[model samples]
Target: MIGLDPWSPQAPDDPGLTALLEDARAAAGDPVAALALADRATERLPLPGTGRTAELWRGLAELAAVDLTVARTLEPHLDAVAILAQAADAGYAVPPASGTWGVYAAEGPGARLEARPGDEGRLVLSGRKPWCSLAEHVDSALVTAWVDDERRILVAVDLSHPGVELVDEPWVARGLPRVRSTGLRLTDVPGVPVGDPGWYLTRPGFAWGGLGVAACWLGGAMGLTRRMRTAATEREPDQIGLSLLGKADMALTAAAAVLTEASSAVDAGLVEGEHAWPRCVRVRSVVHDACETVLTAAAHALGPGPLTGEEEHAARVADLQLYLRQHKAERDAALVGQAVADGMPVAWA
Candidate 1:
């Protein structure tokens, strides 16, 4: 496995980092190694500054011909946030604020950024984004906004523009805190358009993005399952033991299978257009159930240790439990019901 610690302060060229990246890239060419590398890299890096890190992991996962939508969603948002953080650390201006969907807005008053025609006959942006991720470190960013009465556009803009305002309130969360998901307010910051209007969320890429979040949750469940095994072994023979171990193992296996199947469906582009909402609802349902099962088993197995201890494992368990609240059982059920009402097929091949 690649040994570079992504959280290290050393430059990207550091020998360890280099080796890790090289190994990851090479493994991308293989099936088993690629999956291993993806799993390991996520475990190691967790929050990477460049989208490339997540992309690499995404690519590795893709090698299995698996659907990667859930993984993709989590990465781009985190990566975008990471870029803003890196930009700030490098002395670039960044906006202050928080929230995943609230990053786009005219939060403050300044030279408003807008896209205009460039010398190459391409759309150019002339606006600033407030509260952007890694805004301090990134001299520019890729932003999406309304261009006219009925058009929206995504563009790359320079953060250093006089019209930009970057508020620097850092984002705080129990998991993936390294993402620096700040907020941004835009002024007329110069930018270049990436694709046509509304393409960002409507494309195959966006579908995969949502799937990525499901994958992250799956990973967390996997982590909990591992912890459960360790805790089970540490249990006294008479204490809550083998039953818990078996339950956790079974839950993990089932969850992993569901995730793999859903990922495969997404990778094959079978989860789009008419099937989009149904597929999403189904995956969300599976993930919600998986999380519940694994977490329950872990809690039962670990007993009061997780609740009372200050150890890293305990903290991880707590975090996972807290996050599961966001994927409410009720909400998922509603989605499934809606999918059925709409007659969208939920089965994946």
Candidate 2:
């Protein structure tokens, strides 16, 4: 609510933040500018579900309107704020703030964090964390590691410490290349336990945070969809072209409506109930499917010229494809399906 647009030309808290936003807005392939923007976003990160749900969603949309890669890259750090808040609410002692934080709990084969507790509440984290976004750039991160054979614990790590290495080799995806997401190899990295065992994934806000990601995907898709709409209006289009445009418009409009409605529901404290996770899943699936349709229709309507020739449009499409992979699509849809099968009302207002 502070700024109407995330990428507007309004004065930021500082001149450096303004420059950072401008450079990030211009960054299509330049990862450095995007990194600077990521750093600036750290200063005033909001703790999610603290009644800023709608504002965070809108900010993601505005950022997506500029560069989806930058938006995707910065979103995890924002998610970290929410995760930290959840841990604190769960009665876990988070590490003292040094700088911005990220949530990197995604694991791959042979990935596990070993937590060795030291005297005076210090802990050393070692092992491989396979999927960390903004691993190298972020100052700290809330990492997940095996506390026991049965459960995982959340550790707040100072990424600037010695023996913390970011392995970019595994992050070979070109779609979100500017995001700098990679594997973290920690060799006795110092940290502090954030939450009790199994708090990170079990928290209610986890799914709600996932919805925030879907919001970004929706925003990116709408940005790309608008290009097709603009093209359809600018040129004298045939019926087929107009038909594709219409389809794209419908998908984008419906998705936006769902997002707005969800925002209102969130503001009304509707997401605090037992069905919150399922509801979040439903919203995410809707927006995700809508975004896929928008991307397809935009490509078919605008043709390959915008994709291969235009700089910004192509990047948006590519970034969206990569960003949407954050969630298990089919499985997410199946959750909603199962909920409906269990006689759970969707409250489809």
Candidate 3:
């Protein structure tokens, strides 16, 4: 008979497991991570109380990572939307399965996807979407389409049904590739209505989603900083080593400060009403700059050899560089300009 001691200190704790636990705890505050965790945990743990606790923890974590204004603006719907979409993709039953929405910068002919309420009160989606993140994994999507007189309408469609095709070409982003962004084609698929036409701009979804992206980028940046520090400490002292060390410290400090400030602002409810758009844009700018700065520093410190090397740190640096492309700095600049034109003070100006 084998005896198991529940309180035995001699029980070995796996270092990898311990590290994973710490990572999960840290990620709990990030909306993306929290949402992902909630989705995964709920799937695995069906117990009602346990599932609720996991969901609560995930929500709390998201709140901790973002500002209250941003959260309030987007959290009401985006959280449920993303999670429900993921769950549906994973073959779970999700109510309100089909809807319509639109995409920007689409490829192929007839780039617009439209949805209209059907006789049975369902939505019929028609159009194409490029760069639909997690499209392949979702059961349905809310797509945007041009209505009468060129007005936009939000429509939802079921991906599992015919007329909905997900292109296998996945978005090759450095981080969060597991989310599996892909192109989607909908040729009159069944769908449902979400909100008023062209309401995506008026809703908090875009802003909140941007914040989630920022959090994920910040996480990757922090991970890179940690790897760089470790590598610097382990390497032989040289000009590259010294330069890398200094840059890592500076870049990490700056990025961390900006992220903290943005998170604090979100948590404090300073992002609502007329101030919402401008504040969100400003935070996006800050995150974009910080991501660039940190990635550059990491790459410079590691050098071309380690950067292209097969090591984990090298791979991470490469991934960070790739992920930075998603920031859309030009768009942020445009938003800032518009805000300034509208009499909002540009923070840096």
Candidate 4:
């Protein structure tokens, strides 16, 4: 595995997290085992936008490099914690600590979840929540449900509640197959309001959390880049192999720079208000593009030998490709371009 970048301030020395990541790498094939490892990793992660935001992102990147699905399973758990933290800081109701958590805020075309007033002023959720990854595994989740047509509220729900139901949908994806993302069917499930309507998406931590996912993409790319580097070194030194290595290195370097700068900005409390969305869009786009470049370079350098013969390499390629799609590509770029067009400061200097 590629070690943390020593030059980055985001890279901190944590022996405990290091050992956990090593264990996670060893258990990459077993999703259940890896998720257990991720649960243990929760305490090790620092809340983003805090003083140790760099370390927080570094931990996420390292986890992703180990296994994208493992990272995927764990990231939402961390994000849920961050959201709860934000809510707590804002004097909102917070749920009792659970074993593991997930953030299930994805909406789809089917039935939608709604929060209704319950006994003793509590909220109860009912309806279907889609795109809930590890819904069967996590102990709880911070879910988003419609309070009305114009308002959606974030609520913390216990996954093991009697009213919660997991749909047995067949997940046939080749990449990250271990972490199945299915839908949840709720029947008046008890829930605690996390934040007010629109707070989940509007918070500064939301942007910080988005950047955390970008860090994972960067790590997955680094994993592929390492395979390319090893392939180039193991065999005869051809100009083509060297060129690919150079390409991967250059792309990763640029990605790391943007990630580091953005991470520092987050830690400094600079990612807030009107600037958060644009800044996050820029960092995510840059890192996503860099990951794409690295993937291409690695494929060219290592050829079909590793792709066919290596299980890990093939899995990483597929996993990275799927995970990077979370960035939304040109659709997100259009938002950034619009921001630039609207005269947001472009500090290239």
User: Cα lDDT of all candidates, in order?
Assistant: 0.50, 0.73, 0.50, 0.83
Which candidate comes out best when scored by TM-score?
4
Stretches of candidate 3 off by over 4 Å are: 1-38, 41-110, 168-181, 236-243, 346-349
Give the TM-score comparing model 2 with the true structure, all chains together: 0.86
Top candidate (lDDT): 4
Error of 4 at 222 (Å): 0.7
Q: Tell me how candidate 2 scores on lDDT.
A: 0.73
Clashes by residue pair, model 4: none
lDDT score at residue 240, model 1, on the 0-100 scale? 57
Tens-digit lDDT track of model 3 for 1-349: 0002101112213454233334445553233543333333323322211113222222322332222222222232344454445435445444652332223323356456665667766667666777665554444455666665566755555567878787677355554334445677778787655455655455533454455555445555555656566776686768876776566556545544554555545445454456566666776577667667767777777667665664455544554555556666788788777877887755567
Model 1 ranges off by over 4 Å: 1-74, 77-141, 148-151, 158-163, 168-178, 237-239, 306-310, 321-329
Better of 2 and 4 by TM-score: 4
Candidate 3 or 4, higher TM-score? Answer: 4
What shift in Å separates residue 287 of candidate 1 from its native position after superposition?
1.5
lDDT of 4 by residue, 21-51 (tens): 8887887856677668755777898888878
Candidate 1 residue lDDT tens string, 1-349: 1112211122343354445545644543232333334333443443331333333333323221121222222334444444445445545454431333112433345524456676653555544445453444344456776677566665555566676666566566654233344555555455555556665545444444455555556555665666666665675534556776666566555655665565556546566685575566666567668777777877777778666774445545655555555465787788777777788764552
TM-score-superior candidate, 1 or 4: 4
Task: TM-score each candidate.
Answer: 0.61, 0.86, 0.66, 0.95
